[model samples]
Target: MEGRSQWGTRAGFVLAAIGSAVGLGNIWRFPAVAYENGGGAFFIPYLFALLTAGIPILIMEFTMGHKYRGSAPLTYRRMTKKAEGIGWWAVAVAFVIATYYSVIIAWAISYSYFSINLSWGEDTEGFLFGDYLHLADVPGQMGSLVPGVFFPLIIVWIIVLGVLIRGVKRGIEIANRIMIPTLVIVFLIVVIRAVTLPGALTGLDAFFKPDFTQILSPHVWVAAYGQIFFSLSIAFAIMITYSSYLPKKSDITNNAFITGFSNSGFELLAGIGVFAILGFMATSQGVGIDEVVAGGVGLAFVVFPAIINEFPAFNEFFGLLFFLSLVLAGLTSLISIVETFVAGVAEKFNISRTKSVLFGGGLAAILSIIFATQGGLYFLDAADYFINQFGVAALGLVEVILIAWILRKLGLFKNHANEISDIKLGSWWTISLAVITPIVLGWMMIDLLRLNIMRGFDTETGNYEGYSNMFIMWGGWAVAIGALVIGIVFSLIKWRSNTSAKEETEDISNVNN
Candidate 1:
């Protein structure tokens, strides 16, 4: 195998980790999830989930990657050959995610350009659906592709591919260092401007107002865990793959804490910015905050473009700043997602870096073009909903079960982290992984399954209006579960060679015996 690259500096690794965690989800999803769950009271469960589940799993993955000195698949293979399938499962999850995730970045790029002239104008919703997408009635329909979406999406793939081809130190690390700081500065400017606008106070109050009784609902707790779980980018192969590039002497625990906290802090700031704008929207229309504020694609594509139209001054420039922030956040995270698979392919097949990046990333880019089509939004919605719920959450549950109970490697892993890390892993870490995380994650999985099963995912409006049951099931649920099946197949394939990784496995064996 060729020599592996390490991050140029410790700060580079931390910033890269932060970049991975702080993606489009933190900015668009977290604020709405918090407000809808329990408002002010949601913080209690969210903080609890962060400490118990988020940071603990982060430290575990970092330990595995740093100790085994390999990507996700190689790390799991070295830890115990039987667990190799687990690592490939993670790689598969990342691959599936990258396919749909890339199109989102394309949308941001298009929106950034649209910001220049306020092209979305008064009918932002109509423009997004009718003019921008020309969306189809359902999945599997071959509607004409929109060049507006396709052209910008192609640019996104080109930029990300160029970066991945540059190798880790020169490309991924440097990209994060530049983009993450700029994201912070530009987003802060957006937030400051938003909060001072007329009627901004109304949005903030609605966002932060406590619905104490809502805290009693089981769903609120599940929302907290889900937010932290998905926000940190855990169990998606990115963290482990990124940490594999760290030097042997780096601090593990402190880095996890930093990454986790930075992600949460950014989510809070995003909440502030989003609500302030929502407040202004409501004030301008003489309506309640609830009537104006939203999240997810509506919040980004439709609502925000509308908000910019309402701006008192420099509407185009403020719109440009907002969309640019989205592009930066999405790109930083997208690079890490693509790199996870690049690392896996290179490590598994013993291929060169450039070859791995081309093959793995090329495949994802080809599939991503599907989402740039007129009918693409339907597919993206179905897949995104199921992938995050079943694919990501299930992986988290199984990971803890394997490490803490099946193999009982948590003790040794904890010791490995404490030995190398500045902060010691105490009994609390053990209990979190063994007990708290698994139970919480397990409950989340079961509850989500139950809800989907009972009503079939929002039958009120059919979740997606025109999509058929077969299309939703196969396109969404099947693709998600198929990832696990494909991963197992990859694990069964012959490894080309892994000399240093195997030596580390022997060292772990010596310590165990």
Candidate 2:
């Protein structure tokens, strides 16, 4: 591989890490998970999970990339030859995520324009699914791609590719320096406006009021850990890849805390912004908070549009602000996701950065086009569920096991982390990764398997909800599991023999140049 690219400065790296961690989930998903789990009491388990599973994993990944001094594939190859496939697996998972993820950003970009006039109107769901997406009735059916979505998706790809082609410091770091600050500033404005609105208090009340009783349940704790796992951008190749670009003098522990906390802080801001609007919606409709509140797609597309239409004035302005936040959040995350694959492919194949971005990123963009079709929404939904549940969760579980148990490198990682980091690692890090994380992850996976894999992910009407079993099993599950197979296949093919990995590991003397 060419001499590895590095972040221009510590601030650049920190901003990029925050950008990677803060995504659409922080806005739409975390608040709902908090609301459903324990309202206010969710913070208890949430904080605990953050301390235990989230930060520990973040530190581990940072040490892996910083010490190993390579992209995910190269880093893992340096760690243990047999475990290199795990790195490629992470790269493949990132590729799959980026492919479908961009489609949602495309939707957000379109909605930003529609928000100019509250164009979605009262039947917000219909505008999104029927009028905009032209969603197919059947899951597997691929009707003509939606023109609105296709064009915007192409735009999304263009921006991502343009930035990625510029290499790490010039492209990603510069983008995050501008975008992350802008995201925080704009989101704060939205939150301030939201809280001041009438009935917004009700939404905040619902969001923050502790349903302390729920905390008694074991699942609540598990949910807390699961939320942290997904939110922190670990187990995917993004963090590992990003860390590989850091100077050898970088502070792993401090960076982990900052990145992890920054993500949670953004989620808090999102909660305030989201509930304030949902409160306004409920008040307008003369309904309770529960009736109007929703998460993910419903929250972003359905509820937000309905809320925008009810805005007393400046609805267009508010709508633009809201959707713009999504665009920023989504784009930053998209950049990181693509970088994971780009870095791995470049290192794995000893290709130039430009060529790697073109091949790896170009292919992902092409795959993303399918989600622009009429049946795209159904397909996106299936893929998102299966990939996240099976792919990411499983990989995380295996990662901890591989390091802590299989290879017995957990102590070595901790020592390396403590050597450079301001906050030293201790037995807690070990206990978290070796004991707490694996157990919680293992339980979460088994539970998901029972609910989703074995029983087919339905509660009320059982069996993949209203979708086809073939599409769910094949399209969704197969895509996720297949990432692992593809990753292993890639690992088996060596790019070129080099003895430089050990030199990179031992010779930090040449770092920060």
Candidate 3:
């Protein structure tokens, strides 16, 4: 057996962690979620949730990776052989995410070019759906691949696969060191420009003028927890894999805190920039801010372009900066997502990293093409919703329950983290994972199930976003459930005889069993 890969420096690891945390959701998703939930008041629960669920879980996962020194599946297996499937479950979710997430980044790449001339033209919504996406009239319609999306999709896979093949320190670390800083500088410039616009104060006011009453609602608190959970890239395989590359003596607790806060700080910046721009658009169109506000794809591609078109000057430059920010952010996160499975498969099969990248990443890249077709958005939307709901949220719930309650390993993790961390873990950390997080996440699953099951009665199509039930079944439910099935099945396959990871696990004490 040879030495495992490690980060060149703590800063490199921290930067990589931040890059994974601060993704497209920080830009497109967080602002709208905050606005919809409680305006400025949302931060109360948001910060609380961050402390209770987000950072605590981060510390736990960081400890798992650094202590076990393996990919998610390997880490869990090292924790307890029976628990290995949960790690693969996380990896499978990441694999599903990497497939469509790459396509969204491809859209950002094309939009970055389209920004040069405002090619989306006057009708931004129509341009996104009709011209650019060439969306089908009905759901689940797999029309021909859009040339605009396909070429960029190819480029996205190349860059991501190329990065993964380079290994951790030289590849993933170097990419994050460059991309994360550039993303911040570019986004900061956008934020600065956005706040300086005519109606910028209005947007800022809207964002910060907290309706304290919303804090009283459990739903708002739940939204806060969900945002913190999804935004920080916890409970997925990302944090664990990234931390697995940490050198011995790394500060696990402090690193988790840094990653958690840095991610939230950037989300704050994004919310300001986004709402300011939305305010500008609303003022220009003589409509209320609510009319112009949106999130996700619509906000990134449609509304932003429409707003850019309304800019008094420097439309193309700002558009380029905005979309370019998306590309950088998306790439950093995508790189981490892809690397999760790459590491898992490489270790599981005892293959070279290059071979793993080609085999695993190539497959994800190939499947990503589904989102490049005319029905891509429909499928993308459904898959994203179901995967996030069933895959991520449910997986997070299972992970906490398994680690905290079922296995009762929180104390062991706490001692391990405290030994290596500058900031020692306390009961709060244990209580959060053991009591607070599971309850919140468990409640989240129940609420989601209730809403989804009940939604069928409210719509003619009998499912999410009025997509046909069949489409939801195959495109939505199947993709989400399939990840878990993949996890269990993959765990059943024994590691190859020559696998070094199997030998490495012998050093750790079998406290889990």
Candidate 4:
């Protein structure tokens, strides 16, 4: 297989990794999670999870990829030839994730257009709940779902495909160079605007003022862990796949920390921006702070538009900046998703870059169209629940198992440890990866499941009232099962190919001798 291009410089690599980390999860999700879980109190567990789950796992992925110098599928095969199944599992998870993940990019793009045209703020109330409430209604509004969902999705996919088709140096690298800096600058501008608003001090106090009492709850700890995992993009197969292109001597530990800190710092800044504006809006409107800080669509669609509307003079400008930031963040992450499956196709089928990208992007685009017409928002929420939550936990398990057990058995880690870092892993690292991480994740899964079960079903809308919670429960399992099935099938194909190649190589060597 042809090797993918390495990042031109260490700075390029750091920016690309940070770009993947700092997406909707950082800006859109993190603040909501932090506020709901107890404001400053959420930082406690978030910091712990960052150190244990985020940092260590990040180091593990980078080290594995750098040491092997191959994509996710091939990296695992090179490390544990006998247990090549693990490698395919990782790729499968990545593929599934990429499929639905593109839909999110589409949402961001659609929202960007809306924001740019000032359509979002104009219909703030109605847009949140009317026919335009979800992308699923797009088809109904147009009297044709295909054009409404499929057509737009295909267009977005083409743009992404065009980027990937350019190859890594020209495409991914170039994108990071432009998007990362722009994203940071836009975020800073938003933060500045938010903090300078009337009653902004109150918002800052709400976010920064630590309430130790909230830390005592198990829910807060779980939120922290989830945030750390989500923010870092760990256990998503993204880091592992991206890291495969790193040069042999790259400093894995330092790079991981750089990416981690850059991502987290951005999230903290975003929280300050969001909460401060939320505070000002609450104070001016005489509404409760909680009402202003509602999560999910409410934050982006409802609350944000409301706030933007309040500043009539700068409404359009701020709206454009906000959506542009979303576009940059979403596109950068979308590139990673496209690369994951494209790399898989390249390794699995030995296809050329153009063909691999076309296949991957085409498939994701088709899937996304279906999602878009079916009310893209619902699909987004569901896919996110399954892929982000369940997919991540599953990925974490496979990673820890592969590194702690399979790689150890092959003596890969022993030889590669010196190449990446001087730090030696003892039983503690193994225990955390194999036992502790999985158990904690499993418990969280159970909690999520219990929450769904207790909520029961609603008959009126033919969906659960707590739809997000339901998605997390059912969606997580669906992703895990889909991933497992794909893993087994791909493993068999790879094993057969590897066996045939070994025999052929032996024949050539023997004939030569």
Rank the candidate models, highest TM-score first. Answer: 3, 1, 2, 4
lDDT over C-alpha atoms for residue 41 of model 2: 98
lDDT of 3 at 361: 99
For 68-114, candidate 4 gives per-residue lDDT tens digits of 55566666666545445666676676676666666555655566666
Q: RMSD of candidate 2 to the true fold?
A: 3.4
Candidate that beats the other on TM-score, 3 or 4, i.e. the better one: 3
Q: Write the per-residue lDDT of candidate 3 for residues 1-513, one digit (tens) a residue.
A: 235799999999999999999999999999999999889999999999999999999998998899888889998887777778888999999999999999999999999999999999999999999999999988889999999999999999999999988989889999999999999999999999999998988888888888999999999999999999999998889999999989889999999889999999999999999999998988887888888889999899988998999888999999999999999999999999999999999888888899999999999999999999999999999999989999999989998998887777888889988888879888889899999999999899889988977987899977898888799999999999999999999999998725434444532244464
The candidate that wins on lDDT is: 3
**Between which residue pairs do clashes occur in model 1?**
none
Per-residue error for 48 in candidate 3, Å, reads 0.2
Winner on lDDT between 2 and 3 is: 3
| Candidate 1 lDDT, 187-279, residue by residue in tens | 999999999999999889988888989989989988999999999999978999899889988899999999999999999999999999999
Residue range 50-146, candidate 2, lDDT tens digits: 9999999999999999988888888877776777899999999999999999999999999999988778877988998888998888778989979
lDDT of 3 at 322: 98
**Residue runs of model 2 more than 4 Å from their true location after superposition:** 453-462, 497-513
Candidate 4 stretches greater than 4 Å from native: 121-123, 128-143, 146-155, 405-418, 422-436, 457-480, 494-513
Off by over 4 Å in 3: 497-513
TM-score of 3: 0.97
Each prediction's whole-model lDDT (CA):
0.88, 0.88, 0.91, 0.70
For candidate 3, the per-residue lDDT at 228 reads 96
